[model samples]
Target: MGNAIELYDWNVYAIFAPFFAAQFFNLKHPVSALLATYAVFAVAFVMRPIGGFLFGWLADRHGRRMSMLLSVGLASAGSLLIGLAPTYSSVGLTASVVLVLARLIQGLAYGGEIASSHTYIAEVAPAPRRGLWSSIICISSMSALLVATLLGATLSTVLAKQQMVGWGWRVPFVVGGVLGIVALVLRRTLSETNAYEQARTERQTGSRPSMMRGIWQNRIAGLRVIGLVVGGTVFFYTWLVAAPAYAITVKHIPAPEALWSGVIATSVMIVVLPFAGALSDRIGRRPNFVFFTLAAAALSFPLNRLIQNKAWQLTLAMTIAGVTIALVVSILPAVLAELFPTHVRAAGIGVPYSLAVALCGGTAPLLQTWLATSGRGDLFIGYSVVLLLIGTVVVLAMPETKAKPLE
Candidate 1:
């Protein structure tokens, strides 16, 4: 439930970027307006590392349950604020400011939410089957995207264009806000992890656990996280956010068709994620990461080019990318949790994960749009390949953590 709510909160941004662009940005051209809005989306990510460290410290020192509760509340408020915010016509620049502010709060909440939720779930899972259970976090997030895209597609289908542009876009944000509250209520009943409790009880005499120091001391592990996340984040946003937008904006595909394609692709991922996780449990984490990174490097360009002219091709390409990406995302939480001691697991995961995601994931959509518009789409493909190559090198160097005991 916490995963569901957190992901819904995060995904609402991508699913509604077009509507927000129309409402908040006052540019003359539609493309310009969208770029500006997506720029705001990237800007919000600047807050994520700070949020990660802050809530990570709270979780490390106090409890994961408390951090989860607080993060959800923050996200809920941000969603509600965005839903209730006035349009540019009514409030002018203030509306855009409000939008940026709302996104910042949401970024902060989601940054923390990811770490706490990942740590909590990984700690509770059985040692041998941890990959299967940990994959649920990413699956829940993908499912949220599926739900949001389906709803957006349905709304576009039913509402007239003017009606959708005018008021229909607010519905999902409002609904997400309510769902966040429900998640908060559900999270309150969550029990503290025995791992954390045991770690606390067995603390070495005079050995203080410092979040910042822990991350710095675990610098090698932290860098591994950054490597994994950089390519993963870009792939995720490209498939989930940029692809749909590119189809609608560049290919001139109808909005409903583009969104429905995303819905279908995301639904496929929802099924594929668990299988990938289980496969990692059997084969090992390093092999899957290496395979996924190499596959992404090899396939990204041709497959991306394959989708350019038609909606069906776009759907097929995204679905393929989704399946490949699922292999990495499904096992990532367990792998990350296994990298650090229980005393600093959340902080360890949160710091580098948030940093890489903020730097890479958040900027992906804006970067893709800019590159495409500048007629250097080939360069963007090269850029993606380079990142994947870096990830492949790192994964090859890092030791496999399959069925490893969480210290």
Candidate 2:
């Protein structure tokens, strides 16, 4: 729940950005305002690597429980700040600055949450069932995403256009703030896992180096994490995060219909994630990633071609993309956590994973929008296919760890 709530805080901004972009930005045109908003969104993502390092070290050295507690508190505070922030009409440029600051805080919290939660979940699940258990991470994430989409659909349906742009845009941030507190309260009940306990014991015995040194030592594994993440993250943000906005703004779909299409596609993701994870358990981690990358590459062109101005077209494109996404993300936490020893698991995964996502996933939406506006949407599809193929190569090169015990 805590994990889910933080992600909601992270993503709710994207769903509502089109409504609020003009509020904070002083751009002349709506398109310019939207672009500026996404630039700020990208700026927040750039902070993820720094946050990942800070919190990942804390988790590795302190405890995952404590790191998580701190992260959620920060996330809630950020959400509240955004909810209460003044608009440009009242505060001028300060409003935009406030939004940036708040986004930075949430980015840090999100980076921390990813590191700690993935390590925690991977450590606690029984070895044989780790793949299946890891599905909970993305399940929680996608569930949060689904709620934000539904909320968007609901607000778009019931609220007048003026109402949405005026005050309705801020409602989700406030709701996320409240949810964060609830998640914090719930997370308090969680205990440290046996793996972390064991790792902590070893640390006291002087079995580990400084966090920086440890991360450096495992840099090769870190690079692999980047390679594995870059392609998948691009594919993910393109179809899932940016689809609705692209359809509404570019393809000229109705706002409510665009949002509803996201609701449907994300619902499909939530359902398939667990089954994909279980499949990885039955076969191997490599096969799921291999298949996902190859399938994503193979389908990118045709699926993109299917998208049109209609909501159904957008829904169909995204639904297909969602299924392919599940095959990689459902077992991704397990794969990432397994790459390093417990001593540096959180930091090792955090630094590189966040870096990859910040670079590739963060820019994906803006890049796609720019290309589409330039009459080069097909080029972006080709770009995605190339990235997925690269990811496939990386997956094939990496060792299969399905049956290996976590160090």
Candidate 3:
């Protein structure tokens, strides 16, 4: 539930970018305004590593529950601020500044939420079913994407352009704030993970140093976590956020149709994610990642070309892209969590993952836009392929964690 709320808030901004861009920036150039909005989106990612380290440390020293509760509270506050933000006409630069600040807080909360939640879930789940349980994190996130897309689509259908640009875009933020509170309520009932408790007890009785020192001692493991995350995060943002804008702006597709394509693609992803994760449990992470990445790299050109066709073709192409994303994202939480020891697990997972996200995922949309504008969309594909190949090599180098005990 917490993960769902986090993704919903995060994706709501992306899905509503066109509308919000017009609302907030009031720029004459549509692409420029959209880029500006995405720039703010990217800015929030800059804080992710900070959030990850701060909350990861809190989760390690204090408790996951406490960290989660605090993070959610911060996210809720940010959402409310966005819901209530004034337009540039009313507040000048203050509006954009406020929006960026609110997003920064949201990014920070989200950075910690995923790593801590996944770590907590992995610790509690039985070894054989760990993949299945861990996949729920993606399932919840995809579900949030589904909701955000649907809401964005519905609002576009029901509200006039002027109304949406005026106040309708704020509706999702208000709804997100309310749902964030509900997630907080649900989180209150969650028991502390036995793994965390055991780790805490051991620390109290043993001689473990700071999490930073422990991470330094396990630098190779930390690099492996970063390597595993790079492909998944880059592919995810590319297909989901970058593709829609690319379809609409560069390909000159209708806005409604482009959004519908995204909606269909996200729905397919939700269905396929759990199955892929389950497959990884049965087979192994390395093999699944290898197959998925190779297939994706091979198909990148064909898929992008197909998506530039008619609306139905676009939907089919996006569905295929979502399948490729599901293969990587569904298994990532479990794989990353399994790479570290319990003592520095939170910091180990959170910091490196956030770093990769900041470097790759957050910049994906902007980078793809620039590449396409420079008459080199294929370059973006090549970039994605290189990351996936790097990740494949790293995955092959690492040991499989299937059926391994969480601790």
Candidate 4:
């Protein structure tokens, strides 16, 4: 639930960027301002690796609950700052500076949140059902994106363009900030996982277990996570986060319509996640990943061709993309968690995973928008296919963890 709220706060910035870009940057032209907005969006990704390492160390050294508490508090503070950030008109470049600082905070928190939560779930779940349990992450994540899209659609429908630009864009940020407090409260009830407890208890009485040492010991496992995450994060952000904006900006689809289409597609994806996770448990993690890579790679250009400046077409494109995406995301956390022992699990996932995302997913929106603007959208589609194929190779190289025991 805390993950859900944190994602909502993070994704809301992407959804509302078209409306609020002019408020932060001096760029007056719509495309220019939008591009500039995406630049700041990528800036957050730059901080994610640092956040991931910092929070992962904290989680391993202290406890998952403590790490979560601090991450959520930081996220809430960031959201509130974004909600009340001064405009270009009021504070010149200071507005953009505040926006950057806010995103940096969020980047760090989200980086830690993913690694800790994934580690927590894999540790607590029964071995045979770990895949199914891991789907909760995807459910929370997709549901957050759905809610952000719904809220964006709702506001765009009710508010005038001027009003949306002036203040409506801030509503979701404020809501996210307040709800983050509730998540922090809920997270306080969490206990350390048994695996972590055991790992700590069995250690030599005199020596402090080093988080960095644990990560170093499992360096190979961390490398596997980085390979698997690169394509998954890039494709997910491209089709889910960047798709609707592409429709509205490049195809000239209406804002409300494009956003509402994203909501519907995301809703369907959420419904598919648990079933996909269960299937991975029944079969094996590799097959689901294989299917997602093959299917998403095949769908890239065909789905892009399907959108024609119509809401339903956009819906059709994203719905196919989302369902295929569900196959991978539903099991990915479990797959990554199963790679490392509990002693170094969080940091192992955090370091390499966050680095991959910062390099790929963080740049996806800007890359997609630029391709569309330059009339080279097909090139972006090709780029996605290439990444998917690389992911396929990585998935095949890794052993099946379906019945593997955590150390």
Best by lDDT: 2
Q: Report the candidate with higher TM-score, 2 versus 3.
A: 2
Q: What residue pairs are clashing in model 4?
A: none
Which digits, one per residue and each the tens of the lDDT, describe model 1 over residues 1-407? Answer: 77777778777777777766879977878889889988988988888888889888888888899999999999888988888999999989999999999999999998898789889989999988989998899888888888888889999999988888899989998988989878888998999999988877776544755777888889899999999889988888988766887777766888888898999899999899999999989999988898899999899898878876677988898999999999999988899999988888998898899999999888888888888878887787888888888999999899989999988
- TM-score to native of every candidate shown: 0.98, 0.98, 0.97, 0.98
RMSD to true structure for each model, in Å: 1.1, 1.0, 1.4, 1.2
Off by over 4 Å in 3: none
Candidate 4, residues 18-48, lDDT tens digits: the string is: 9999999888788889899998889899888
| Candidate 2 lDDT over residue span 1-407, tens digit each | 99889988988888888889899988868778888888888999988898899999999988999999999989988988999999999999999999999999998988898899999999898777889999999999999999998999999999998999999988989999988889888889999988888888987887678888988899889999999999999999889887898787778888899999999999999999999999988899999999999999999999888887788999989999999899999998899988989989999989999999898888888888888988999888888888888888888899988856887
Candidate 3 Cα lDDT to native: 0.83
Candidate 2 has what TM-score? 0.98
Clashing pairs in 2: none
Mind giving the per-residue lDDT tens digits that candidate 3 earns over 1-407?
88888888887887787777866786988778888888888889888898889988988888888888878878877888899999899988899989999999999998888658877877887888777778898999899888887887788778887888788899999999988889899999988988889999998999877988988987998898778778777778877756666677667776667778889999988999889989989998788888877787787778867866466776888788898878878887778778888878888888888998988888888787777867898888888888888887888898988878866
Error of 4 at 390 (Å): 0.8
